[model samples]
Target chain A: MLIDVTDAGDPRLVDYVGLRDAQLRRPEVSRFIAEGVKIIERAFAAGCTPRSLLLQPRWLPGLRELIDAWPDVPVYLASEALIEHVSGFHVHRGALGSFDRPQETGWDELLGGRRLIVCEDTVDHANLGAIIRVAAGLGWDGVLVSPGSADPLYRRAVKASMGSSLALPWRRMASDSDLQRLRDAGFTLVASTLAPGAVDLAGLEPPAKAALLLGTEGQGLSDAWSAAADRHVTIPMAAGVDSLNVATAAAILAYALRP
Target chain B: MLIDVTDAGDPRLVDYVGLRDAQLRRPEVSRFIAEGVKIIERAFAAGCTPRSLLLQPRWLPGLRELIDAWPDVPVYLASEALIEHVSGFHVHRGALGSFDRPQETGWDELLGGRRLIVCEDTVDHANLGAIIRVAAGLGWDGVLVSPGSADPLYRRAVKASMGSSLALPWRRMASDSDLQRLRDAGFTLVASTLAPGAVDLAGLEPPAKAALLLGTEGQGLSDAWSAAADRHVTIPMAAGVDSLNVATAAAILAYALRP
Candidate 1:
């Protein structure tokens, strides 16, 4: 059902209000907002149930099939100007869909995979999203994030991943002890660091099942996580440069250690 | 010279005004602004002459030696709030330096080395910066960009490269004939693309002197460039995923084709 919304403050459009405000975007609300027609399509293709959708009529034709399939979902049509006023920013792509956030994949299923990306405290949504996109693009099995990491389902993360975050398998660890669980399942834990004594990445012989541990942008793999890994690998960099961006580093490691 | 300026509109601080506004930042003026202490230090370390400096009083102690060395260069001190007001954004690291932009390296000097990254119309400063950082960290010799590419000296690009854009040897091509120059220099032109029939990146052997061509974010390598390349290499991606981010792709290619 298409509901035409003329008022920007309509209660039904609450999910999208002030979306640019970081404080107002709560991932715990059990719903994730996918922006643009492509990402919304990916969310639907991934079998996510739409809670509702808010978009200009111009986008309705493009998403008609997806909307038609979910007859019970409310599709709110609004003017582009109203969307900008409500979201506090221009909705350049002209569409947004609120979908039920997918549940975290079970650890047992995640650990059973051959290749994985384990991010520790990667708080930047763009970096986290790019990591997911890289992992999925390179055919990696899944992603595991520490509790402190950014929500992969956050609007910015989902958009940065070009919707790959919707299609990729990802989960947050209940606790750091999850590292031990990965090891217990016979997965090799490889820590990516710039510290000395780390084996050159070019020389690494990745095992059948490997978990690459990447850390934050500022403070790389924490001392505890670096010390606990089965191996430490460093991409040999030139003199005077400190390190690569966390996401770029992840991409290199993902491709090099691909199964 | 330490000059205390309480006014945000002081003409001496013109270089630091409206930094958040792209139209006001003119690289044609032969001056580029470096934000933060670390980047400013990189600019000095790279032997870039200081036109002037602006920062809060708290950061003075750290940069005392550098300031002392450049006795004639004026250092404008201001409160953090005034600095933010003038820059039109928070000077998060509390310092900004206006430095003389260095001249582009000659093609012969850049191509004398074995490896290079060639970017075409990469308008995004962050992507260009990341590519530079990846090139430097991976020990690539230099970078070449089409005339249409973003200025590597742009504040945002310099910061994104972790200041590597300042350290790396990069030059803009005068025209498409630069490709012919690389070819004449015995540099193998390898175009990175997602097009079918491109050789699998893993199986290809990089030439002794190779130049990897990267294109804009939305479009892959242009038809002319792709056709002119000596070889086309692609990172095999999983189905359903369109492509990796340009910077992420650059990192992977740089690592894989490392000399």
Candidate 2:
């Protein structure tokens, strides 16, 4: 449905308003806003049902087939100025989409993989999404984020991942206790750390089923998590540098240890 | 050295004004501003001479030693709001320093390294910096950027590198012909590409001296450069994914091909 809107306060456009409000962007929230034409297309390709779309006419030709396939889905046509005025920020890509958030992969499926990435507290959304992109690209089966991690479905993350977060199998753990389930599945838990005794990464041959544990941005894996791992591996770096960015480390680790 | 200023338009503060002007931030510009105390400290550690310092009082105590050492350098003290207002953007890390642009490495020193990262048209400052950080962290000896690449010493690049860009050896290429110098130096020019029939990265052994060529963000390597390479190697990814982010690819390649 093509709905033309001139007013910023149109009741029908409520889903796109006040998007910067933290309450609306929470991971538990039922909807996520995909910000660009490519990401919106990815959302549809991944089977997400759109609640509505706000776009300038310039983007129509590229997205015509998608809008045609879903006649019931609201497609709000607005002038770029009105869209910016209403959204309170310029939509850089000039296309904004609101979609029903998809369900996360279940533990049984996420844990059945031969390779996995477990983020303990990867709070930065871009970092979390980048990790997912590399994990999926290199053939890792899934990703597990601790409760405190950022939402993989968040718009910036979705953009940063180039929409890989939408395609990959990922889930948020209920608590630290969920980690034990991986060990029960006959997986060797390897922690990426900079501790003194950890074996050089080049020396550690990955086990049959392996889960690599990554930590927060500034700190390496927490002591408790490091102590809990079946093996500890460290990337030897040049002197004077403290550590690699969490996402960069994930890319290296995922590629080096890929099955 | 501790001159307090209340005016946002103060004449001595001209260096920090209109910083958003691309003309001022150009790579050819004789100076680059370092935002935040940490990057400022990195500039100092890297032996770059300071032109001036702008800071709020809270950062004073921590920087007293360095301030005292450089008594001739003007330290403009201001309130946080004044600093933000004058700079036209908030300095998130609360301190900014203007420094003389450091010199780039010459061909002899840069090409003599056993492992190097060669960036071609990497225009994103953050990506360029992350590539340098990973190269430094993974023990690559130096970096050589094509003329069109982002400035390694740019503030965001410096901060993104966690100051590694300051310490790493990197220089600009006069033209693609600088690549010829690498070949003459016994450096194997390894091009990273997704082209058909390229050898898998895992199957190839690192030559005695290796140089990895990285391309622009979206289009991947240009045909000219890919054909210029001594060896074509690729990281085989899962189907449906087009390619890895240039920086992420650099990380995996640097780590795997590290000396």
Candidate 3:
């Protein structure tokens, strides 16, 4: 059944308005509204099930089968004007889909026989998304998002990740105890930092299990976190340049430690 | 000498007009216009002498000494209205500077006994700028802008690079001869590609004299360039994820090859 929404205030479209904040609330109820067909299709292909799909009447004929593929999923068909109103912005390409928010992956499940990528205080949505995209590209096993990190499921992050957030396993951890749990699970926590005694990234031998930890772009990892790391490594940079963007740095670090 | 012309089309401000087209025609002219005090300072520190420092009347008192610090450099004062007109956009921060264009560095001189990062066809200004930022941070020797590559000096690219392009040595090459010369000089040409026999990035050895080659965002690399690489290496991404952004890939490669 294709429902139609005519107003921006439509109750059914509430989830899609001013979506930036909703994603940060709780991953379970925080739905990721993928607006374009490509992103939605990619997310779906990566095994994400859609909650409901909204399409411009013009696109319904071509997207009908994909919507039917999720037989129980509600499909909403609306006019272009209605979509623009409901979205609070022009619905440029004329389609949208809301996916049931997947629960955050378990730390144990994520650490199970895999290389881990940990982000601490990386709050920028685009950077977080880029990190996820690279994580998926470089074959890292999972991403562990610290409490201070942005939600990987944010619309911008999802789009920036090219929908790889759907494919990459991600979990959120709130404190030292959360990080310690991974350490207890036998994963070597390698902190990417510029501290004294840090080894050149290439010099370190690939560990059987390792979690590449990165910090905020402005202020790197907290002193406590760096002190807790099993190893600290730095990418040798030119004298005058500050540092790579957080996401770029994470990708490089992840690629270097891939088992 | 502060020249204040409030109108958008003031004659003295002609050089700074139509930045977008100027960028397309000759993006390397970036030494002429850069945003923010820090970037302007970096460019000056890197030996890019200013022709004239343009400023809104309000920021004049604070910037006078810095302008005076460059004794020979002219400090051009203008009204906020004039600055907006000349810049082709509102002077969001209320100041901008026009500096004398720096001489293009010789490729050999730029690469003299140091690591070189190469891009074949990376077209995104942000990605190119981010790569330059990474290059600066990672202690790479220089960057080689091959045919079809984005202009490093484009406004967005420069900003994204965080002005590292000023300190980093770069040169644009219009002919295949430049690449051939690099090859003959024993620079190991490593192309980031998905070609068969492309070693996993982690498995590769850091070369003494190497060029980390990259392609555009959507398309990976051209056959003509890919075949020229001494070796092809891949980041070994997870299944179903697209390629990493070029700048991110460059950072990873540069970090992997850090000396």
Which pairs clash inside model 1? none
lDDT of 2 at A175: 93
In TM-score terms, candidate 1 sits at 0.96
Q: Candidate 2's residue-wise lDDT over B16-101, tens digit each?
A: 88666565547888887888898888889888899999999899998999999999999999998888888778689669999998
Native contacts present in each candidate (fraction): 0.92, 0.82, 0.98
Q: Specify the poorest-scoring 10-residue window by lDDT in model 2 chain A.
A: A17-26
Kindly list the per-residue Cα lDDT of model 1 for residues B1-259, writing each as its tens digit: 9999998889989889888888533557678889899999999999998999998988999999999999999999999999999999988778999998888888778979999999999999999999999999999999998988898998999988878888889998989878999999999999999999999999999899999999898798899899889999999989888899999999999999998
Per-residue CA lDDT of model 1 for A72-145, tens digit only, reads 99999999999889888888777999988888788778877999999999999899999999999999999999
Query: In candidate 3, what are the lDDT values of residues B86-119, reduced to their tens digit?
Result: 6767656666667666666786686575578888
Candidate maximizing TM-score: 2
In model 3, which runs have C-alpha deviations exceeding 4 angstroms? A1-15, A18-29, A54-65, A71-95, A111-114, B1-32, B51-65, B71-95, B110-114, B205-208
* Candidate 3 lDDT, A1-259, residue by residue in tens: 6787766677777666664344334555657778688888887887777888778878777776787787878787788777776666676687888887777777557978568888897788789889988888878888888887888887778878888888788988877668888888898999999777899877899789998889898789999889889999987667766677888888778877776
Candidate 1 vs 2: which has more lDDT = 1
How many residue pairs clash (N, CA or C atoms closer than 3 angstroms) in each of the candidate models, in the order given? 0, 0, 4
**Native A-B contact fraction in model 3:** 0.98
Interface RMSD of candidate number 2: 0.7
Q: Which stretches of candidate 2 lie over 4 Å from their true place?
A: none
